[model samples]
Target chain A: MSSYIALFGNPNTGKTSLFNNLTGSYEYVGNWSGVTVEKKVGILRQHGVPIVDLPGIYSLQPLSRDEGVATDFLLTEPCSAIVNIVDASQLRRNLHLTVQLLEFGKPLIVALNMVDVAEKRGVKVDAEKLSRCIGAPVVPVIARTGKGTKELVRAILSLSEQSGEREHVAIDYGQDVEAAVQKISEQLPDDLLASKRWLALQFLEGNERIHAYLQTYMDIAPLVAVRDEAQQALGRPLAEHIYDARDKWIVHAIETSTVIFQQKPLTLTEKIDAVVTNKYLGLPIFLTFMYIMFMLTFDWLGSPLADLLDQFFSGPLTEWLSKLLTLVGASPFIQALVLDGIVSGVGGVLVFVPQIFILFFFISLLEDSGYMARVAMVMDRFMEAIGLNGKAFIPMIIGFGCNVPGVMAARTIEQPKERLLTILLLPFMSCSARLPVYALFAGTFFAKNQAIVVFSLYVLGIVVALGLAKLFSSTLLKNESSIFVIELPPYRMPQALTLWRSTWDKGKGFVRKAGTFIFGGSVAIWLLTYVGPKGIGVSMDDSFLAVIGGVLAPILAPLGFGTWQAGASLITGFLAKEVVVSTMNIIYHAKDMDLLQGAITQHFTPLSALSFMVFVLLYIPCLATVATIRKEAGSRKWTLISIGCALTIAYTISFLIYEGGKLFGY
Target chain B: MVLTDLRQGQKAVITNLAITNEVVKQRLLHMGMHEGEKVCVKCVMPFGGPVMVEVDGQYICLRRKEAACIGVR
Candidate 1:
């Protein structure tokens, strides 16, 4: 039989690093669970031994979904040995879980992880002494460096093979609680012995799940009555007292076995946090960081790459396809269908791929570099001020990169109501794909104040998001205050490979969406316009979509973009936000424009362009985001609430901007 | 008073929890934060947002509003 080992530790304890070094896989390394809803699995190597890195959790006492998964696996799985990875720098807290695991009575090998960080901070641990006290071999390891991993593996292999009766370290819970647990355990079924202590504690805590579990498999009514009496006599929660005693015992043991001073060297994260988390300077620093990122995105990378792709696809690809159709003697109607509808519509959306990649690449860098958590911390206060939870900031930040993942990532928020609200409001954030449309307008009309105009549009997006979040929280989704507990990961120099992998994954996702939805949507939009009542073609600009858009045009007149072009763009944008840019391109013959001729200037007026950009920025999120809302909200009603609210807000804001500018004689 | 209102390093035993939501109640129970747990308030972040508390030998951070629901004596 193959030996099995389990990797366990608190969240952000570099357990994943150790797992990665041992296993050699590059899975997503998020500081926080992008969502707290799922359990993830990964394998590690140890000479024919299977090692499983359980999800990073605080203790064996399960709370969140991931925590529940970890605790359930450890308590029930047939693991030959447990590799308890303790964060060396934060020993006291890390050891809490270690101590809890110790009570499980498995063959334990302690990995004192982050020894390098601990030593730098002037905190020292006597691994030898610690080994003696816990009756487990303690090995100092820097998981991030893969140092001491071979020894850790060897220790696990030897421990797993040892078949002696395991000794459980009794945490001296107070006499009364211990008496109650002993009585309860004697009444429990034999099957509950694996986690007898945890089960005992759960019974004392009045856990209904344990009661149901016991009732299903064993006779336990007598046990429950006795546990209820014990609880009543205590006049308090037994889990709390048991936990207190357990923690005290562990703290005392750690103090006796380890040496620490009040003073420790400042960690790199500490030094960085001092400025980045500063109350006064923090927002400005964040703004400056975003400024540099966006400036580089547009001026350095996005514009050139976008121009190159636009030339390649429109100039070469389109010409080749058209020539092929001409040579093949294809019907003019079919030629127009493939060329004008499919090529023009889909090709327009695909050309902005360069800009989307540039945006997501920067976002991936921020996430990998550990700066995103700080951004969350900084944004938390303001989010809280508006009666929203801090965790909302993370998904909203992801929304700026792309709303699909942002919507998916909302699962991390423990409160369902808050999670739904965040998802519904997330689409209001100006996603990266929206940036191209904004850029096209700002480049064309407000070229003199391009950066400022782009910045203002982003601000408008945020303002609308906040207002909607507050509105939804106050009116429709007012359920309860959300549970907000987030871990801030220490700053580390992001590995290049990790950054590249994330960038590649997100870039690939963009290309995939372009091929599927964007391709299909463009063709659909083209057929609606081209295949009209008239023979192969009347003016498509006078088709059914055009007439409906014309009717809606008057509604947008106040925003200085009353044209069917802008109206039709908004209608197609419901398919995908990137379609807004493509809709503009197809409607305006953007593919035919000469790049050297200052295209933006020749195309759109300043006021109409600004209004069009703002409308795109503020309008309804795509159909996919709406579907996510329906699924997460579990109701068509709230989904309708979200749509209605978003559309109203978008129209109101755009109207204010357009009407206000005209009133001031713009 | 809420955990955030505690002076730095003050220790208190949770007497009651005002959690009305079942999800939060289940989460609190899972973290060993049932009523009567002895929780020592560690340093609060510079702002009155996420308050760090040492509960059941575990140092976990929670938002102030969440902590407010945990009654301490």
Candidate 2:
């Protein structure tokens, strides 16, 4: 049998990096918490076993979906050995989970990570002493740069070879709690798989999920009786006492196994946070960073490269593809599909790849530099007004990159109402997929201030989303928990390699999307314009794309850009936002962006172009997002309401922008 | 006094976490803020924002209300 090893740790402890080193696979690693919200499995080359990387969770008892994912996997998943990663700098707190894992009765090897960081703070840990104390093999390793990883791998393989269970070590939970734990363990059914003491302790600590799971196997009445009896005798919640025991043990363990010296004061992260997270200056600093990012992407590097790629695809590439088709004696229909449909459609979306990567680069920087958690702290006040804490804002930041993961990131919110609200508001964050449409329109019409123009749309998306969050909180989902406690990881300069890898991870999806479904979508769309209800080779005006677009056009006229071509593009945009540019390219029969720009000018003024971008910014999310909403929301009614709300808000906002612009005589 | 009652940069040993919410209390404990631990105020954001607190070299940001539930001396 192939053995499986699970890598577990607290959030932001570099477990993903360690997994990458062991498995030789690239998974997105973020310095902030909750980056890995689900379990990821990769094969470990050294041991020839599958390594499961679970989410970074503070405890086995869950308060949120992501935590539940990790907790569930730890309790239920079958693994021959467990490699528990502990951040040495934060060992006291991280050891709480380490104790629970030890109680899990598995062959465990503890990987003590960040020892160098600990040493920097005048703390020195004796790995041999820690190993002796915990009764597990401990190896110090730096997960980021592969320092001391060989020892960790050796320990893991040696333990895997033994195939023996570690002795289940029970923490002294005082007298009453110990009595209850013993009773609960004896009463537990034989069918139970995990350690009975671990489950009973978890139950006493108010792990409702485990409690519910245990009820299915046994009556649980005897256990509940023992718990209530223990609670009455103790005069404090068993959980608090359990934590008290853990804290006492940690203090003792630290004294015996570690040494502390006077620490260096005021690191670079502190000096920077003094200004960037200052009361008055934090929001301004955040806005400035965003402004700079946009300026780089739109007005500087990204736009120029995108323009070059656009011209190449529109002129030389299209001409070369056409000639190749002619040389092969292909049919006129096939030639049109390859050139007009696939090339123009996919090529139109492909040109924006540079901008997508630039945006990803900035996002990765913010995430890797540990700025995102501070943004949560900085944005807490406004978030409170919307009935959420600063922790909820992390999902919004992630949403600016892509809504699917952003929506999934909501799993970390801890509050069900807030998680749903975050999901509902995510579509308005203006994902990178929509960047192409905004860049095309802004570059074409708002040339001198394209950066400012695109930046305003991003701000608009936030304003509208926040406003709706406020509305939903007051009317639909009332009584938020308003609990916000977040860990602030120390800032480090983002490594160049990590930044490149992260950017490529996010940006590759766009290109792969273009190569796969978007290629087919483009061909299908071109055929819609090529073959209509009037049959093959009908005029675009009479094509099926036009017929459906015509139905939606009048409704959009009030928001400007009411033409059939614009309507058809919006219709295809439902498939994916990049397809909007593709549909427009094919409809205008434009060979290059220069031609596409000239063709759009005939149908839209600068004001109308701005209005059209606004609609795309707030309108319904792509099909993948809608499916995620359906699944994550877990209710058909909520999903429909989400779509309905997005459409209503999009129309209202676009109408206001268009008519309001005309009223001001712009 | 409560955790938020401390001046910025003032350090104190935690006496108790007088919090009722089960999840919040468990979370604070798991984050290494149990009784007898030491914590120092780092900064408090302006206008009802979260207060940044440092405990054993790890920084944690907590809402003012939640921070108030933590007793220190």
Candidate 3:
């Protein structure tokens, strides 16, 4: 049988990095909590034993959705061993979870990650002493540089090879609590993987999941009675008492096993935080960085490469394909399907690959360097003013890449009301899928100010999202503000390997979507345009698509660009935002085979194009996003509210832009 | 005094967590802000924004209102 070992740790302790080092899989590793929201499994590179990378969590008793995932897996999965990774520098807090894992009685190995970082701060850990104290093997490793990982894996394999039964440590929860736990342990089911003592402790700490799990086997009334008695005896919530006991145990273990010289003073992270989190200069500095990122995406780096790709696709590639097809005596339909349907459609979106990669590159850099948590800190006041917590900003930043994970990332927020509001407002963040539309329009019409125009659209998205957040928080989702406590992880130079991995991970999604959804969508649109009420190979103006687009055109007339082609693109855009560009490429190229940029310029002036971009910005999120909102919000009503709200906002704003432009005689 | 009242670089030990919300209390406690733990005021943002505090080698940022609920001496 293939043995399963889980890599577990508190957040920001390089758990994912170590998993990557072990499995040779490139999962994203950010220096913050809640980065891995789901459990990822990979086979170890050498031993081939499957390793699961679980989300970083504080304790087995989960407090958030991601934490719940970790705890749930531990309670249920029959893992051979648990690799409890801990940050050597923050051993005090990180080991709180470690102590709880030890209670589960699994064959456990401690990976003392970030030991170099600890040593730089004058802290030295005796790994053997720690192992002896905790009754588990401890391996010191730096996960980021892959240092000492071989020994760590060898330790895991050795531990797994041992006899299945290993000793489980039980923390003494004092006299009163221990007696109460003993009473509760007798009532636990006999078949549980975890010890009944651990279950009894979790019951006393009010872990509902444990109670619910035990409910299936036996009545939980006796368990509840024992828990309440313990709470009363302890004269406080049992969770606090249990944590206090565990904390003392951890402090004792550290004191006996580790030594600290004089502490190293805070260095670069502090000096930078002094300015980056400054009251006066913080927001401006943030805005400056955003501006530079956009300028680089649109003007400096991405656009020039995109233009060269566009030229190659529309010029040489098309000519070569057409000549080859004609020489092979291919039919006109096949020629059109290959050239117009597939090449033009998928090519339109694929040309923006450089821009998408660049945007993700910058985001990964900010995330890996630990600057994003400070951004949340600096924006807390602004967020609170709008009745949301600062941590809500993290999901919105994630939403800028895609709304599916963004909605899921809201699981980190403790409060239900705030999480829902974050989910509802995330669609307006102008995800990377919409980048091609902005690039197409800005490159065609607003060429002189391409960077600024694109930058303005992103800013507008945030402004509109904030407005809606204010509206929702005060009206439909009113609740007390959740606490804002986030760790500002020490900054480190971003690893180039990690950065490239994340950039490729996000950028590859776009290419994959183009090949699948956009490819299928373009072929369908081509067939619809080719076959009409009259016959096949008719003018597109008289085809089935024209009739469909004609019916939808008038509804969008007030928003400018009320043509059937625009209407058709908007309709297909519901599937995915990138498909909007693909739909346009097929529809426009069907008539005369014109370049997409030139075709867009002919149909839209600068003002109308700007309005269209704003429409795309605020419109309904894609189908995947809608389903995610429905699932995460766990209510069909809120899902409808999201779609309804987005449509209303998009229509109203686009109407104002178009009508206002016409009134000003633009 | 409450945590927000501490001046920059001032050290104090948390005496009581006055907040009643279970989730918020647990979050703070998990960050090593339990009673009797030592804390230092790192930075206080302008205009009554959040306060940054260092506790157990971890820097945590808390809103001013939340900071006021953390009793220290």
Give the per-residue lDDT of model 1 (tens digit) for A1-666. 444577888776777777777777655555554432344445556365577777777655554434556766754567777888887877766776777677677778889998877777667888998777676789999886789989887776677667567776677676777788888777766765356776777666655555555677777878777777776777776656765776677667677777775445345655686677665677789889888777766766666787787788778888899899999999887787777666766676676677777777788877777777667766776787666777788888888887877886776676667777787788888887787677677766665667678777878788888887877678776767756666666667877776777777777766787788877877766666655556445576766567757878888877777777667878888878877765655555455324412544554567767767877887777788888878766789878877887788777777877778788898
Ranking by TM-score: 2, 3, 1
Q: What tens digits encode model 2's per-residue C-alpha lDDT throughout A100-128?
A: 88877888888899898889877899999
lDDT at residue A30 of model 1 (Cα atoms): 53
Chain A (candidate 2) TM-score to true chain A: 0.97
Regions of candidate 3 where Cα sits further than 4 Å from its true position: A1-3, A235-237, A590-594
**What value does the lDDT take at residue A571 in candidate 3?**
85
Quote the lDDT for A93 in model 2. Answer: 83
Return the top candidate by TM-score: 2
Candidate 3 chain A, run of 10 with poorest lDDT: A590-599
Query: Clashing residue pairs in candidate 3, if any?
Result: none
